[model samples]
Target: MSHVSGDLVRRYANGDKGIPADQVWALEAHMETCASCRQLLASHADGIAPLLDTVWAGLTPAEVPAKRRRLSTWITPAGFPWIGMTILIAAIAMLLDALTVLDTSFVLLVAPVAPMLGVALAWNKNADPMYELVAGSPRAGLELVLRRTVGVLVVMIPALFLAGLPGRVSPALWLLPSLAFTVGALVLGLLIGVTRASVVLAGVWLLVVAGPSLAEQNVPAVLHPASLPYWALIIVGCVAVLGLRADSFSRLLR
Candidate 1:
């Protein structure tokens, strides 16, 4: 049996758990000569597992969006390109409704533009010349734009409801008009880009879609397929791609 005067060596080798003070010096001397034991200790190192990995019961999943996109974000932002203007327009609409200058219902028009133009200009700005070459490229453009449109809508929706609350317009009336108007603006914005070159985007859209649609006081005329609601609804249908996967944009860029 190994024996030692140093307490440390006695403790380590014989399970003494304690040893004389003189044995401490003997233990140090033994350790200096023991290359094998030193290497064994080094291999054990700190003997600790990484807390984050080892303690976790399971790994968290990764996904493109952690949460479903909020429609509110699209509401107000879609109505205007500039955040300031987007914010400003919603504020003005609310104010106009409050002061009796305009119907609280005007908030509807402001909501859609944030999404339509906001998405359009953003897509146009980022547009690689190659976007048009591939099939389904427009879908990608639509998704990116639509996501942005949703952001605008999110803010505008609440502002709209609050603005109308004071005016005694039923909530349903405000919401339907906003929805109808958003549908209208989105279509008008997309279509007028094809029409008069002399006109700016919004001005042309305003003259063609908003002006005409509102002029048709009859709900049936407003809903007419040749008119704003029809076109707006169609454009909204096209923009439904927002909720879909973005693989199309990647392919289009390719």
Candidate 2:
């Protein structure tokens, strides 16, 4: 039942003005644990009332039809299907390896680019229903893109690792290339759309690496241990480029 003094709460809510630092901190700390004091502070925030009204009025009708959801609400529904598909692909690849249906390790061949597929969907204007709304925010762009990419990766990397486990696939065989390819997609996405960039990278890999490697029954040179240092360099270079060009993603093409 204890509370910050009404006068202090009112002064704190109205404006810091001449309030002492210790008093301000005390008021804030009390407000954190006191709902009645919070209400008192809100009541004192007369100047903010009109602004709050304006913001409430601007809420879309679509937003009011249901109870506000959790942080999961922020993730677009479009991403779920794509994430599922990415998981299914990993599962199927593992199954194929288990059955020995393929002459080569199908899992390794796809692992590098598999996660990017979901990453592409994570921010694709075509896939995300709220892309315009989300993309238009000032906090959008590379920061948001990287966050979503990380989210996709969180689900993907483990799945890929699990798939590769039974086959004894070396993490180096797929992990480095995966980072390199993901960074490549991100860098390319700044120029083109992320989805298109993913398609281009996947297509090129299929045409130039996967298809040939399969036909010749040889592991691609890029995925070989001798080539790992090269892949490491590529990953480093690409990440540096991404950091330098991070600003470009802010004004990314729709």
Candidate 3:
């Protein structure tokens, strides 16, 4: 195969002249096998050379986004299934309470802790396939965490309301505790893994609060009206810790 003329390559590179279609095709094909001619073309490109390089540079992997097609800047597709499962569990708990199969006290026992599981799932590496992408985003960490947490509560609190209807469990009984537990889990999550932190808190609630409440058929003291002030204090304190440690969420464990 013959090499492209220096004149043709320069013309093509610089938009100085338009070559005939047939010759342009042959010249391009020839350049594929002719590194010397390719170099010669680039040398003749002059002022247009840098523009060509810039265009090519933009096509490289380095120029591409680290992550792609994330569902939202904050939440990911991985969160949906977990949130749905949490709601389903809440609905089942409601049904059980309605049937009186589990005592109303037992229903109340799990209500505050149920949403924490969803929050854990929202950001946990094990639960989210895109955890790295979600957590490493520029808007990751506290802002992203808070958005997903809000999503969990938006879906969860309403479900709890419907479920608690049959049991006559007051919203006041569970709401502040739910928020407090979620914030506390997040605060602890900054040190330990979020999944582990949430699991630990939930397990503690089950063993210390739920089990005893169920066995004795009474509301746990923590869920009582007089305890509301302490829950409020927990909420304020955890929020401050979360804000202080916001950057930690951006660099989550792989």
Candidate 4:
């Protein structure tokens, strides 16, 4: 790397992202192959992490809320996967109708499609046209999580209500799966930076939860029953995961 490039990496490592981004991008490109430069970037991250924590902690509620909203600026990018999610949701909705699953119960899955896709599209930086904006801010992680989660919920709930009009599963009941999947996968995404672990965990969680249900095995009634405490625990666990690690958790939006 050139001398200028070395200096920029130092600034970035020191968490001085104020450097014109082009300068930093050059360093990141070079650092991709250069271990010494990567080491520097890691050092910068160490300093930046603590500083970000302080910025996050001292954030006023008002500031936090606005910052979260700012992350909503991007629409999910258009792509095959999103089209697939939409098609899957639509197919499920149509199947519910044909099967005459509770008029309303079947359709609930329909609403969340757009929002889910939208957020997914936004977080997907692969074809992202907004890297500059996303790259500029550390808070992008938190905002990214909040935007997609909130956006999908806004669409998913309404569509579900519309599609499942008959006395199908209670919206309250179905809402659990949607919310749980979002937070759970989102959490895993943040930690692993990939959907594989989250997807695996989800499959396992489903087996544990729905498998017992589908098998309809005889169980001690008390052990089998899903009590209020169970729901409370579920909620508490999800909330803790979201709240305690908003920074790290938000990174999962990727």
Angstrom error of the Cα, residue 110, model 2: value is 0.7
Which tens-of-lDDT digit does each residue in 24-56 have in candidate 4?
777667877888767766765765687788898
| 10 residues in a row with least lDDT, candidate 3 | 68-77
Question: In model 4, what is the error at residue 20, expressed in angstroms?
Answer: 40
lDDT of 4 at 96: 61
TM-score of model 3 vs. true structure: 0.72
Top TM-score hit:
3
| Model 1 CA lDDT for position 237 | 67
Model 2 Cα lDDT, one tens digit per residue, 1-254: 66788778777777868999988888888889988888988888888999998898888455455776567533446788898898899889888889875566888998999988888875687877777787778987777778777888888899999998988877778988888888888878877888999999999998999999889887888888888898789888888888898777666365
lDDT of each: 0.46, 0.82, 0.81, 0.53
Q: Which has the higher lDDT value, candidate number 2 or candidate number 3?
A: 2
Better of 2 and 4 by lDDT: 2
Regions of candidate 3 where Cα sits further than 4 Å from its true position: 1-74, 101-103
Cα lDDT tens digits, model 1, 1-254, are 24333434334544454665666566557657876554543444343335445656357654566677565433222234454455666678667657655422455444444333333433332332333442244545445545655665565566656654655544443344345445444444343431121125456546765565446532233323345555556556644632343343434321
**lDDT, candidate 1, residue 100?**
51
Native-vs-model 2 lDDT? 0.82
User: How big is the positional error of residue 145 in model 3, measured in Å on the Cα after superposition?
Assistant: 0.6
**Residues forming the 10-long window of minimal summed lDDT in candidate 2:** 68-77
Residue 126 in model 1: lDDT: 35
Which is superior by lDDT, 1 or 2? 2
Best-to-worst order by lDDT is 2, 3, 4, 1
